[model samples]
Target chain A: MTSPEERLQAAQQVLASWAGDTQSPEPNRLDVGVAAQNLIAAIEALIGARWGYLSAITGLDLGVEAGQIEVLYHFCEGAAVLTLRVATPRASASVPSVCPLIPSASVFERELVEMMGIQVVGTPDNSRLFLADDWPDDVYPLRKDAVLERGVKEQGNE
Target chain B: MSEAVVQDKKRFVVPIGPQHPALKEPGHFEFTVDGEIVTGATVRLGYAHRGIEKAVESRNWTQSLYLLERICGICSHVHAMTYCLGVEKLAGAEVPPRAQAIRVLVAELERVHSHLLWLGVAAHEAGFDTLFMYSWRDRETVMDLLESFTGNRVNYSANILGGVKCDVTPDLASAILKGVDFLEERSRHYLNVVTTDEVFLQRTRGVGTMSKEVAERLGVVGPTARASGVARDIRIEAPYAAYADFPVQIVLAEAGDLEARFVVRIKELFESYRLIHEVIDKLPPGELQTRMPRKIKAGETISRVEAPRGEAFYFIKSNGSDNPERIKVRTPTLCNMGSVVATAVGHQLADMPMILAGIDPCFSCNDRTVAVRDAAGALVTWESLRQRRLAHQENK
Candidate 1:
C-alpha cells in the first residue's frame, strides 16, 4: 500500500496534470475538476493508503461574474487538508453527489443546496436540512450580491 | 374473549415545546409516544438563529473575535481560541510560548467551569437542588478566578488573533492555584456524592445507555463518547496551543450511560486542574502577541481544538482581505446530539430529562428545540397534565 504522503504526491501529480500551467500554485494548492462520475474516482485514487474523510463541501455563488457556481471540496487525510475547486455554469450547475464515496458529504451537499440553490444530482434525500420548507427558492443568501436587508427582515419575522 | 371483541386503537400526538421549562432555548420537538414510551421524535430548530455566519462576513478579523465568543457562553474561550488559531494560520503568525501557555491554562480553566456547571444542571434535572447549589457554588470559584485574570467572567475575550489580550500576573497565577486547590477538594466531594448516592445511581445508571458501537458510529465525542469506551480525544489526537507541549491525559469510561457520562465529566475536572497547574508551573516569559500582517493572502485552512464538550472545528477561507471570505464552525454538541436519539429510544418518559442532560449538550449551539408530540402528532404540554394526574392518583 502506498503511504499517505506518496498518495498525496500522486494526487498532486494528477491534479497538476489537469491544472496545466496552474500547477505549482503558491502554497502548493491546485484547482481542477473531472466529470461528475470521475470526480469520486480521482478522489479515491488521490487518497491512497490514508483514510480520506470528507471534511466539507461549500458552494460559492459567483452570480454573473463567472456566469457559474463553484463548489469547493475540503478533504482531510490525517492532518493534511486539501481543497479541490470545481465550477459549473449557472444554467447547468448540477454535480454528482459524493455521498456514495464519502457519507459525511451528504449533509454538506444538502446544506449547499439550501444555501446556494445548487442541485446535487443523485442525492438520496435532498429534503430541506437547514432552511425551512417555506423558504423562497429564488433567494440564495450566501451569494456575494445577495440582498441581505430583505432576507434579514423576512427571516426576522419568521 | 379477545377474538370476539377487537377494537381499533387510535394513535396520540404531543408537542414538547418551542417554549418549555425543560429547555433553556426555544426549539420544538414533536414526539409520538406509545403509552409512556417515545416511539418517534422530530426536532425543529432555527428559533435562536442569529445569522452568526453572515454577521462574520461584515466584521473585521479583530471585531469577529468577540462575535465568535458569543456563539456559546459555556465554551467561549474555545471559540476564541479556535478562531484565533485559524486566522493565525492564515496570517502565518506564531503565538509566543508564554501566550500559548496562558491560552492552555485559560482553556482548561474554562473546561472546569463548564463541567461543574454541567454537574449542577444534571443534579437539578434529577430534582437534587442541594447538590445543584453546591456544584454551582464550587463552579463560581473558577469563574471568579477567570474574572480576576481576564477582567470578565463569561465572554473572557482574552484571545486576540495572534495572541492573548490579557497576561497572567504572578498574583493572578497564585490566586488561580489557590482556586484550583479549592475546586479539587470540592470536586472530590461532589464525585463521592454522584457515585455513592443511591438516588443519583438509581436515576442515571442504566438510563439512556449508549453502546460502544452505537456511540462510535454516530461520531460522538468528548464525555459522551468516552462514556461509551471510545478513546477519541482531539487533545490527544491533534494537540494545538500548549497542549502540543504539555500533553494531558484523556479520561474514559465504559458504561456509556448517564452515570458514565457524569463520571467522565467529573473526572475531567480533576484532569483540568492538573493541566492548569502544569501550565502555570512551566510558565515561560516572552511577548504576548505576534504581529500579523495587514492582509491575509487567499488561502483556506482547517483548525480543530478540543473544547470542554468535545472537538470544536473552525474552517476559515481568506480572500486576501482583512476579513474572512468564509468562516464555518462545527461545534461538538452537533455530533453528540445524534447519539441522544439512539440512547433515548427505549428510555422511560420520566428519564428523559436526565438522559438528555447526560450528553451535556450545548443545545443553544446545536440549534435544538424541544416539542412534545403524541402518537397522532398533536401538540401538548405534559407537565400540567402530569401534575393533574398525580393529584388524581393522590386523591384515589
Candidate 2:
C-alpha cells in the first residue's frame, strides 16, 4: 500500500485549485476544506482516480452563532481517510447529490435531508428510509435547533 | 393462454416485516412481485429507532459510552469499544498495550458468537432446522465464556472509555482456551455441512450470487464483501487496538452466492479461534484501565472498527465540553442494505428470506428516520404505515 501522505498529494494534484490548505491531524487522514459548490468535483476526482471508497458522510451543525452547517465526505482506502469538508449557510442549506456518481450515496443523502434538514439537490430517491412516516416535518432531530417537544408530540401521535 | 389471461398477470406488491415471519427484527419491506419473482424492493425502518444518536448529545462524555453500547444487542461490545476508541482518540488519551490486546481478544470471541448466531438464522431460513439447532447450541460455548469473563452475556459492557473494563485472569484465560478447543472442532463439522450437504447446497449454492464488482459498487462490508473476494477488513487495512501486534488471517470465498457467505463466516470461526488462542498464549500483563480527563479537548476524529456485521464507522466531534457536539454512526448494515435490496430483485419470492438474512441484517443497529410526506408536506403516522403494509398484504 502507498503511504497516506503520497495518497494525499495525489488527491491534491487531482484537484488543481485550493489544494494548499489540507490538514493531517492523525495518521492516514487528510482533511481539506472546500466550497459547497466544489464538493461534487472534489469527490468525483477522488472516485475517478480510484483513491478510495465512500466510508461515511457526516453533517455538523456549527450552532446558531456560526449560522453555517458543515458536511464531511469521508473517502477511505485501507486505513487512510481523505475528507472533503463542505459548509453551507443554514438558512438555505443545500448540497449537490453525489448519488449519480455513487449509487450507494442515496442512503446517506436521504439521511442528510431528514436529519440535518439539508436539501440534497438532485438525489433520485429521498423516501423515508429508516424514519417513521409520522415523524414531523421541518424538524431535523440532529440539527442544533431541533425541538424536543416536536419529537415527543410526534411519538405521542403514533 | 388467452390474451386476457396474459394481460391479467399484473405485478403485485408483498410487504414483509416491520412484523413478518421472514425477519426476527422489526423493519418493513415491500417487494413488487410478478408471478413469484421479485421485480423491485423497498424498505422502511425506524420501528426500533431509540434516538440514541440524538440522546447521546444530551449525556456527558462518559455516560454516552453506556448509551452507545445499547445500540445493538448482538455487537454491543464492539459498539462500546468503537465509541471508546474514538472518544479516547479525540481526548488525546493513550490506551495501554495490554488493554488493547484484551479489547481484541473480547472482540474476536464476540465475532465467534455473532457468526454462529448468523449461521443458525440463515439455516433456519433455508429450512435446515437441524443445522440451525446444532450451530446455536454450539454458539452457547462462546456465550458462556463471555459471561464468565465479563459477567454479562449479551451486553458485556467490557469496554470502558480509555480501555477495557475487565481483565483476563489465569483461570478465565484457561477456560476460554478449553471453550475454543471445543468450538474449533464443531466449526469444522459446520464447514463440512454447508459445503457438502446436498440439500443445503441446493438452497444456497446459486442463490443471491454477487460478483466482486457489484459488492464493491454497493459498498458491502465485513464477511459479506469478503465472501465475494473483496479484501476490505478494517483490522487488516487500519490495524487498530492489538491488530498491529497480532494479525488475524483474512478468510475469502470466490463465489458471491449464499453458500459463499456461509463458507466465509464458517471459515472466519477458524480464524477467530486461532486468534483467540494466540491472544491467550501471549496475554500481555499490565493495567486494564487508563486515566482520562473529565473534559475532552475540542476536536473531531473517526474510529473505524470491523464489527461482526462489518465496518462500524463512528464520527465523534467534541467541542471542548464534557458532552460531545455530534456523533454519527454509519453502520455496516446501512451499506449492505443497498446490496440486499438490489439482490432481492429477480430472485424467487421463496428465496427472499435467505437472501436478506444472508447479509445478516441488524435493523436496530441501522435504525434511523425517514420522512414520508403527503400533499401538504405533513408527516405520515405509524397508523398509516400499518395501513399501507396491510393494503399491500391484502392485495397479495
Candidate 3:
C-alpha cells in the first residue's frame, strides 16, 4: 500500500504533467479554477472510489487586496483526509460543482452559495439553504459586506 | 347508522410545525396523510437559523471559539474541539501528549452526555416518562464530572487553539473515575430497561427502519449509521487527539431500527467509560498547550475530529492575518438529517416522533429550515388554510 505522502506525490506528478507546470513537492498552494479541475481529474483517476468521501467543502473570501475566493475540498481516503485548494478571482468567482460526481457535495455547495455568494455552475439544487424565504436575493451574510442587522419581518405581518 | 361511508377520499396535506409539540426544534414538516398512514412528507427547516456561519466571519479567531461552542448546547465541546483543531492545523501547532489524552477523555465524556440526553428525549417521545427521568438522572453524573474539570457543564470551553485550557490533576482524575464507575453500574440497568421493556421495545423495534444502503447513500453518521451496520465511526477510522494512541472500539448493530440505534448508543456509554479510564491511567507528562503564533501564514489546512455525535470537520484558510481568511464547519447532524427524510417516508403518522428522534435530529447544529412543497411543486406556507386547521385541531 502506498503511503499518504506517496499517493499525494503521485497525484501531483500526474497533475503537473497534465497542466504542463513544474512539479513541486508541495501542492497545497496550487492555484484554483483550471488547475483545480486538472487536480480533481488526477485524483479521481488515481484513487478512484477509494477516496470517494467528499467530507466537506469550505470557501474563504480574500478581500480586495487579492480579490480572490478560496475553495477547499476535504476528501477522505479511508481514514486519511486530503484537502485540495482552488483559488478563484473575486470578479468572476465561479467553479464547477462536484455534486454531479459526488452527491455529498450538494449540501456543501448549498452552504458555499449562501455563505460566500460564489456561483457553483451547473449545481442541481441552488436554492437558499439557511436563509429566510423573503431574504433579499443580493444579500449573503458570510460575505465581508453583508449586513447582519437587517431583520426580516415577523411571520404574522404582511 | 347504515349510511354507506365514502371510501375513496382525497388525500389532505397536514403541516406539522415550525413549532409543534412532537418536534423539539422549530421546523415545519408537512405530511400528506391518507387517514393515519402517511403518503409523503416534506420538511421545512431554517426557523431557528441564527446565521452561525455568517456570525463566525465577524468574530476574531479566539472569539470564534466561544461562538462555535454555542452551535449546539448538547455537543458544545465537540464544536470547540473541531474549531480549535482547524486553527491549530492552519498554524501548524502540535498539541502535547497530555493535552491530547485529556482531549480524548473530555470528548468521550461529552459523547456519554449527548447519548444519554438523546435517550431521554427518545423516551419522552415514546411517552415513557419513567425512562426519561432515569436516563436524565444518570446523565447528571457525567455533567457533574465535566463541571469539576472545566468549571461548567454544558459549554465546557476547555479546548483552546493549541490544546486544552484546563489540566486534569490527580484529584480531578479520581473524581472522573468515581463518576465513570457510577455511570457503568447505572448503564447496565438502563440497558436492561431499553432492551426488555415491552412498551419501549414495541415503540422502537422495527419502527423507523433505515436500510444500511439507504443510510450510506444519504451519508448518515454516528449511531444512526452504525445501527444500520455502516461501520463509519470517525473515532475508530480516523483517530485524532489521544484516540490515535488509545483507540476506542466502535459499537455497531445490524437491526437498522430505533431499538438498534438505542442499543448502540447505550453500549457506547460503557465504551466511553473504558476510554476515560484508559486515558487517565496513561496520562502523559508534558506541557498542556503549545504557543501559537500571533499571525498565521498564508496557507490552508483541513482537520477532522470525532465529535460526540459523529464526524465534526473544520477547514481553515489563513492569509497571514490575526483573523482567518475562511473557516468552514461540517457538522455531523448535517449528515444525519438526510436520513430523517428517507426513514420517515412510509412510517405511520403517530410514529413520526419516534422516527424523527431516532436520527437524534439537531436542527440548531444542522441549520437548514423546512419548506413544504405540494405534489405539483407549488410552495406552501402557514398562510394556507390547511395549515391553520391542523394547528387548531388535534385529530386528523
Candidate 4:
C-alpha cells in the first residue's frame, strides 16, 4: 500500500498550479495552503482524481490580533486526511463554494457561513443551518468578537 | 382545458411538521406535489437545536464530556468517547488497553441499541407496527446490559478524559454474552422477515433506491452509504482505540433502497455481536483510568468514529487552557440529510415518510436551524424569515 504522504503527493502533483506551503502536522494527515482564487481548482483536482471525499469544511477564527479567518477543507480517503487551508481577512472574509463540484459540500458551506460568519460566495444555500430561524443578522456566534446578546432576540412580555 | 388553467397547474405544497405526527421529531418539510408525485422538497431543522456546540466552549474540559454526551441520546456513548479520544490525543494521555477495550465494548453495545431503534422506527414508518413492537421489545436486552454496565440506560457516561470510568466485571461480561446470544437469534429472524416478508418487502425493496454514484456524490455516510455499496465505515477504514485491536467488518448492500438499509443495519448487528464476544473472550487486563492533566497542551487534532448513523467527525482545538478553544462536531446525520432530501424528489408524496425514515435520521442530532411558514401562507427560507426579523428591528 502506498503511504499517506505518497497519496498526498499525487494530489499535490495534480494541484501543482495552486498547491503551496504543504505541511504535515501529524501522521496520516496533510495540510496544504491554497490561494483563495484557486481554491476550487485545487479541490476539483482532488475530487477529479478521486483522491478522497470532502470530509468537513472547518472554519477557524485566527483571533482578533491575526485579523484573519482560516477555512480548512478536509478531504479524507482511508486513514489519510488532506486539508486545504485558505486564510481570508477577518474584516471581509470570503471563499468560493465547492458545492458546484461536490454537492455534499453545501451543508458544510452553509454551516461555515452561518456559524463562523465567513461568506461562502456562490453557495447554493446561504441560509442559516444550525442557528435558530430568529437569530439576528451580522451576529455570528463562533467569531471571537461576537457577543451572545447581539445574536439572541430579547423576549417580549406576553 | 382553459389556456390560463394549463399554465397554472395548481401545484399543492404539502407542509409536514416542525410538529407533524408522521415524524417523531420536530423537522419542517415542504414538498411541492404535482398530484401524488413530489416535484421539489425542502427541510428545516434547528427546532431541536440547543447550541450544544457553543455551550461546550464555556464548560471546563471534564464537564464538557457530559454535555457532549447529551448531543444525541441514542448514540451518546460514541459522542463522548470520540470527544475524550480527541482531547486525550491533544493531552498526550495514553488510555489503558483495557479501558480502550471496554470503550469499544460500550460503543458496539451502543451501536446495537441504536441500530435496533432505527429498525423499529423504520418498520413503524412502513406501517408495520408488529415488527416495531418486536424490535423495541428486543432492544431492551441491549439497553438492560448497558444499564447494568454503566448504571444508565440512555446517555451512558462510560468514558472519561484519559480512560473509561467503568470496568466490566465477570458477571457483567456473562450478562453481555447472554444478551448477544439472544440478539443474534432475533437479528437473524428479523433479517429473514425483512428480506422475505411480503408486505414489508413491498414497502422497502425497489423503493427509495439510490445508486452508488448518487450515494458517493451526495457523501451519505453510515449504513445509508453502505446500502449503496459504499465501503465507508470509519472503524474498518481507520480503526481507532480498541477497534485497531479487535477490528470490525463492514456490511454492504447494493440495492441502496429501504430494504438494503434494513439489511445493512441488521447484518451490522451480527457483526457487532461477533465483535462483542471476541472482545469479551480476549478482554485485555489493565487499569480503568489514566492520569490526565487538567490543562491540555495547545494543539489541534481530528477524531473520526463510525457512529451508528455514519461517521461522526470531531475537530478539537485546545489552547493550553482548562477549557478547549473550540470543538467542532459534524454528526453523521448532518451528512446524510442531503441524501434524504435528494431521494425525496421523484417519489410519491405518500412514500415520503418512508423515504425520510430510510436514512434513520435523528433530527435532534442534526438540528442546528429552524423553519417557519410565511405570512403569505407560503414556505419561506430561513434566511427570508431572519431578514423579516432584521427589518422589523431596524424599523423599531
Could you tally the backbone clashes for each prediction? 23, 4, 8, 3
Which sections of candidate 1 miss by over 4 Å? Answer: A1-35, A38-57, A62-64, A67-78, A82-92, A95-110, A121-135, A149-158, B1-10, B367-396
Off by over 4 Å in 2: A18-21, A151-158, B1-10, B368-396
Cα lDDT of model 1 by residue, B177-201, tens digit: 9999999999999888999999779
Provide the DockQ value for model 3.
0.28
For candidate 2, the iRMS in Å is 5.8
- Per-model TM-score, in order, reads 0.82, 0.92, 0.83, 0.91
lDDT of 2 by residue, B1-396 (tens): 001112224667777776743558877777888888988888777777877888889889888998899899999988999999998888788888899999999999999999999999999999999999999999999999999989999999998888888888899999999999999999999999999999999999989999999999888999999999999899898888899989978889989999999999999999999999999889788888789898999988999999998999999999999998899999999999889889988899888889989999998898834345667666686567789899999999
* DockQ, all models: 0.19, 0.48, 0.28, 0.44
Model 1's alpha-carbon lDDT is: 0.73
Q: Model 4 over residues B244-334: C-alpha lDDT tens digits?
A: 8898878999999999999999999999999999999999997999999999999989999999999999989998999888888889988
| Residue pairs clashing, model 3 | A32-A87, B44-B369, B44-B370, B44-B371, B45-B369, B45-B370, B46-B368, B46-B369
Q: Which segments of model 3 are wrong by more than 4 Å?
A: A1-3, A6-50, A64-71, A84-105, A119-124, A147-158, B1-11, B20-23, B368-396
Error of 4 at B383 (Å): 33
lDDT of 1 at A145: 63
Give the DockQ of candidate 4: 0.44
> What class would a CAPRI assessor give candidate 2's docking?
acceptable
Residue A39's lDDT in candidate 1: 65
- Residues B257-359 of candidate 3 have per-residue lDDT tens digits of 9999999999999999898899999899999999988777777666677766677877666778787766677888777766666677777877987888887
| Model 4 residue B134 distance off true place after TM-score fit, in angstroms | 0.7
lDDT of 1 by residue, A11-118 (tens): 567555343223323232334555555566666655453344454566766557778877777654434445676777876677888766554355567667766778
Each model's C-alpha lDDT? 0.73, 0.87, 0.75, 0.86
